[model samples]
Target: MEKTSGWRGTREIWIEAAYQALIESGIDAVKVMPLAERLGLSRTSFYGHFSDRDDLLKALVTLWQSKNTGNLIRQTEAYAETITEALLNVFDLWLLPDLFDSRLEFAVRNWAHTDQDLARMLEDADQVRVEALQAMFFRFGYDPDYARVRADTVYLTQIGYISMIKDRPSEPPGPRLQRMPFYVEVFSGRPVSDAEWARFRARHPVAS
Candidate 1:
């Protein structure tokens, strides 16, 4: 039986260290020794859970997929009365960091610039997320082509925000929340009903 190191951090502790390094300094900073040092553990402790650096990297990717893409897909499936309400459900991702980690998303996209495999994974995630949005539009009676276009519009717009917000200081949600009704009208091609806006505001009271 393999002897476990006493006082060494668990797998989650190591992965969280790697996650923070990646978010703060990009992928190159996610080295095992550095992470071990940061955790005040011996380098060998990392091998207890992950075979090597590659294994840890894969775990990070899995975490990103599960947290970011998974939440976005789930939000798209949330119950809503109108297309406007449905879109607002998805928009919760932007306001709720617990739902989606924009810094991690941006970091992974940056990492993908040099990693073909990660690029492919990122592409797959984008396709899956867009498809979820398309399905939501379909539920609201949008035709196929229109749904596709609108889905791309909504997905790309959020992605654009993610990219633009990278490296910038965090901003208040009020500005964006104030403009949400207009965004809903434009994205859904219909006015946001007062009830829908009220519900959305109640769901996100920080901006109120």
Candidate 2:
């Protein structure tokens, strides 16, 4: 078996440093020397984890896909009895990226503008997300065509937020939470109950 202590720690440090640089500036700033400086390590340390700059970039993309798309797929596949519950399950994924790196999301998207291969990967990732949503709706007995459109609406709107660079509010889980019921209802083709909203609010508590 491969050893896991020191090498894993070192690789994670480099990945985290690169992630920070990618989000704060852009992919251009995610160089070995700069990242090593940020981590207070030697440039040679990067070589221990990665073959070169391209290798590091590929790692970043793999990290992103695993966190973002992977979790969304898992959530979409989860059980939900009501349309409200089903919608909430997927909506929760959208509201907070928890394990997903939203900043890295924007960074990679910006990077894709010039990279045909990255753009293609992004397109495939997007299809996967939409299909997952469509599957969720389909499981709820929604028409396939309608489910696809709803999926498109939800996915495209979220992407729009990143592409437009909309300024997120400082205090959240309030305004955003309040509007979620309407979104669920619109997409699921079912009315959300007051009790449902109350439950959602209770689950995602914010200070008054």
Candidate 3:
């Protein structure tokens, strides 16, 4: 057990360096020798942690998902009761995709050859985020299944917009999320009064 834990330390250090390399140089630039150099270790030591570049890359993707999904889940837990606060938590998570620093998502979109583990991580994150949005919609008095479909659409829209920008999010107000509350209002058969719209934007405000 102690022997295994010690090797994981070296692996984690190399994973962290690869993450930084992905951020600074893009996913394609995250090569083994460069990562080893960045970690101030020899390539021989790198091989001690990972068998090859693809192995290290796969580990880095796992670490990225662990951090990203963990934070989103933590945020949702932090604001479990308040619908507005919960929605805010979702936005906070969505606002930082560029920090992943990999165009690998698009690269893998239609390619069946993509890494299965990374694909599964992305899928699971999407599923949990939709679940959070559906929970918010139900609290606002909408049907849960209907809300899940709407939430799915809203998530797709956010992904499209984020892909277009591809940098620090200059997140706009609630209109940036038009279809989200629109899904709530229309699905619940409620009219969105100007006063209520004002309240939503004022209460949410992109970020605090």
Candidate 4:
């Protein structure tokens, strides 16, 4: 029997490797051999864990959906008690990624196009995310319809922004990562410059 490569470090090893593989290549590129290689194991090891590439992909989608749903909702709540803070939290999720990966986002979205089954899986996961985000918006004082609309837009915007960043010119990337904060500010309607926030504060002094 082939050795099974799994549950290393903190979380499942094969699962983490799947996310890495998604990042390096789109879902189309995540073949069993390459994924096994990335995990520093043989195909026997990979098969021992997953019956095939499709099986592994299904597990990856399930794992990501469960974990990322919480992260997205938590991020939305960080700006709690204020609509702006809560809504901007969605933007924050997009700008700062740790709960999920950019490459995986790209791969699955592309994969959903031609594959009906995968498309259904993504639709269901998206529905859950939308529900979570909508609830956050409602908690922040929006009506159901508005919450639904805004949540969908924000969720989809993540896919759009990742596509832009991924398509950037390959000029070594430079130090342009700093610009992400600015993007967050614009998307979230937050004051990008400290000067702006300070000026607003001066106009409306604190009560205490």
TM-score of decoy 3: 0.60
* Pairs of colliding residues, candidate 2: none
lDDT value, residue 32 of candidate 1: 88
- Tell me each candidate's TM-score: 0.94, 0.89, 0.60, 0.66
Least accurate stretch of 10 residues (summed lDDT) in model 1?
A: 1-10
Candidate 2 global TM-score: 0.89
lDDT of each residue in 1-208, candidate 3, tens digit only = 2444234346767777776666555667679777766655678888887889989877765665666555655655554344444454555555345433224344333222355765676787778866866666676666778778767765676667646655666657445566555643443445555554555566446642
Worst 10 residues of 2 by lDDT: 1-10
Write down the RMSD of candidate 2 (Cα, Å): 3.8
User: In terms of TM-score, which candidate is stronger, 3 or 4?
Assistant: 4
Could you tell me which residue pairs clash in candidate 1? none
Which digits, one per residue and each the tens of the lDDT, describe model 4 over residues 107-189? 77777887898788778777878888788767856779877877777677766666776678532322333443454454444
Highest TM-score against the true fold, candidate: 1
Residue ranges of candidate 4 with Cα displaced over 4 Å = 1-11, 38-40, 77-79, 169-208
Over 1-208, each residue of candidate 2 has an lDDT whose tens digit, in order, gives: 2544453337887888888898888888989888877876776678888999999999999998998999888888878777788777777775576845567788999889878999999999999999998898888888999989988987888787666553654435567777888888777778887777677677678643
lDDT for model 1, on a 0 to 1 scale? 0.91
The clash number for model 3 is 0
Candidate number with greatest lDDT: 1
| Per-model root-mean-square deviation over C-alphas | 3.1, 3.8, 6.9, 7.5
